[model samples]
Target: MSIEHMEQMETLLPEWLETSRLRTGQGEVASYIPELAKAARDTLGVFVADSQGKTIAAGDYGIPFTMQSISKVFTLILALMDHGEEAVFYNVGKEPTGDDFNSMIKLELVEPGIPFNPLINAGAITVSSLIAGDSPEDKSQRILQFFRKLAGNDGLDYNMDVYHSELETGDLNRSLAYFLKQNGVLKDPVEDVLSVYFKHCSIEVNCADLSRMALVLAFDGVDPCNGEKLIPRRYVQIAKTFMVTCGMYNASGEFAIDVGIPAKSGVSGGILALVPGQYGIGVVGPSLNSKGNSTAGVHLLERLSKEFSWSLF
Candidate 1:
């Protein structure tokens, strides 16, 4: 980013964030996960970073939250890196389901019995199973190490409170895994796969960490900070495609029309977005809209994308 652009953002972000924060009152923090319900519903924050590492931040950018479904994007990329596209796609389809992120309606209605896409809950569990490891602990460790590398932060670790909460309350996930097992789509034990899945979702991060991770994708798998190839270009392509199609739960099409960038949102109220070769953006607002997206976070992204003409379309 240019110096002038950086200055512009620094001046405007605070005002813009306050405007977006007003929308937080219109939504509520996610309560289904028990632990996610602990977030402060009215808080909002954002961090934006460029390939050269220039950063602009505002609001509660330092507050920590779990990655939730946002982790699914990197997990899918890791699965692709482990088994290639053909092998990974054999277990999950690439199309959006249009149902709730956790709905199993299509699994029963759709043919082949595999998930419609990897970003959804069932599909993410399937992808978790595909992560190469001798045990669930090993698979979870691999995912953590990969995320740390992508974020340029080795201190990244799981919020075990959230992990145990999800594990205890993840009945729907267990159902999905058992169904996949019955359909011959899962090879590992159900609990083992859920262990890996829950652990990844519970990985905690703040806005800066999310921006650094998104920066790698913004530069097509290369870490501009160290000139390292963190992920294969082809796998990044697949991950970005999924983010466009299913990243915002079922509100993806609307997000694309309004913000026009690849983004993934987690129920923890975090959204990781990228502007191709330009910037990586991270947003958080614990208050969630009806579609399970961060209300203030979405509003903020729309505002910035419009002001900067950041839409890919």
Candidate 2:
């Protein structure tokens, strides 16, 4: 039952889709953000890309959604690349919070304002401030450019509607930024950082585009499409290690045990999971389980990893 030995993985997914799609029936879409609540609850999609940039998918794979927290991975990598690993880690730690993504209790409990990891909202905001740009516009443009390179799609840009929606209700995040500022941990102003952070989160993409972005991490930052070194190799290993250990908020450890793939989950019900140097999978089902991850997503990935024997451990 190894993916390498499986003769027809490309043919098995649709049947799996039919059987697995219904797992989303019981879960609910994230309603915290008014825009996020509008996602089609039953809209399930899966896209996978191999090392050679080949792909296969089923269901609503082409339907577009915001990158949400999944953008954390790319931005973290970009910050590391521009500032060097040592500089970036000074502001963010590599540990998981075991709390909700937007929780603020940590900033008080973990003094001096170091974010536990870049996967969480507080940590992501800290990471965004390290992107090596002096201005918000410069920093955001740099983030989008890096994304375009990894996704092979220059058309990527922030969904203004989602950005505004998030910005309007981002009280907790604003508090987190101010906390960092008080401790001298934040490099940019809170207003500027929020602008960059919100824009990155609002960047739109479908499952296919995300799978390709995962492909960059799969190959350790090398864009296999054109032999371009899109991200530094060491930075990617760091990002992937965090993804495996803490990518799914509080459920990260369980996801690692069950799925055994280096993966990241966004609030938009999208999971970007990849097998290093082999393949990458993108799954989206807007209905979230108690862990704030897609309900069917956790189950489907566990089954796929077990059947295919692709555990990193």
Candidate 3:
């Protein structure tokens, strides 16, 4: 089954990538973060990796970018592992807000005020406060180490330029952290929490790295290449559920309907998606549609899912 999937991907990926890249022009590169806006709007890349580390790739697969909001998925898992389900859920709820990922509207309006889900900016900022560390730097190091382990790449690190850019223009996230603190939902200092959040958001990765990370989740917490369990099964299940329900921001429902996969997208124009027990896929396209997903990347996944019947639905 894996061989057949790889064969189909190798044969069909080039054409699919070309078709998707055509949609890049219709979307705009994210400009709120100055460094993110520099990404080439027309570039598109796709990489699919199997359990054994074999891969098939097309387009700008080697180009590196930050994980952005996609990093939130793992951070939520890390927090769950650190604090367990009951404590973690105390600070964040488990429903989609149907608002912008970074919007603070519900934080103000909702009583007893917890962010709707850990995948949103408000909830992620709250989660960052839960990471086990004595200081913000300590927390950031642990997150980087955790990400490196998941990607099976020891050299993984943050793109500092992007990190600084995020910090400079992150007034909204800062506000979210302060609000969470005021609501007694976050225990850490606001800047410390934001520091941890921004650091993880700037972690650099390419399509291949994301494919390896997704492969672990695809196998339900086990690292397919080493046959080792990297995350608890329950935590993996929770993460995948959020990926299906909220990973693409407001367009998650549309993505689930059209592409039918458990996936998370980043504002850096990258996406991490998986075909459970089958393939781990990664894509990047700097141009974004109104919903903040990679425009070309979403189209490419829709095509591949349709062609291979990869949808969970």
Highest lDDT: give the candidate number. Answer: 1
Cα RMSD of all models vs. native, in order, equals 0.7, 1.6, 0.9
* Candidate 2 wrongly placed segments (more than 4 Å): 1-7
**What is the alpha-carbon RMSD of candidate 2 to the true structure?**
1.6
lDDT tens string, model 2, 43-110?
Answer: 88899888765678888899889989999999998888788878888888988888999888877887
Q: Estimate each model's TM-score.
A: 0.99, 0.96, 0.98
What is candidate 2's local distance difference test score?
A: 0.86
lDDT of 1 at 35: 95
Q: Candidate 3, clashing residue pairs?
A: none
Ranking the candidates on TM-score from highest down gives 1, 3, 2
Q: Over all chains combined, what TM-score does candidate 1 have?
A: 0.99
Pairing residues by index, what is the TM-score of model 3?
0.98
Q: Return the clash pairs for model 2, or none.
A: none
Residue 308 alpha-carbon offset, candidate 2, angstroms: 0.8
Q: After superposition, how far is residue 206 of candidate 2 from its true place, in Å?
A: 0.9
lDDT of 3 by residue, 4-50 (tens): 77787799889989988999999999999999999999999999998
The 10-residue segment of model 2 with minimum total lDDT is 1-10
Alpha-carbon shift of residue 104 in model 2 (angstroms): 1.6
Q: Which residue segments of model 3 deviate by more than 4 Å?
A: none
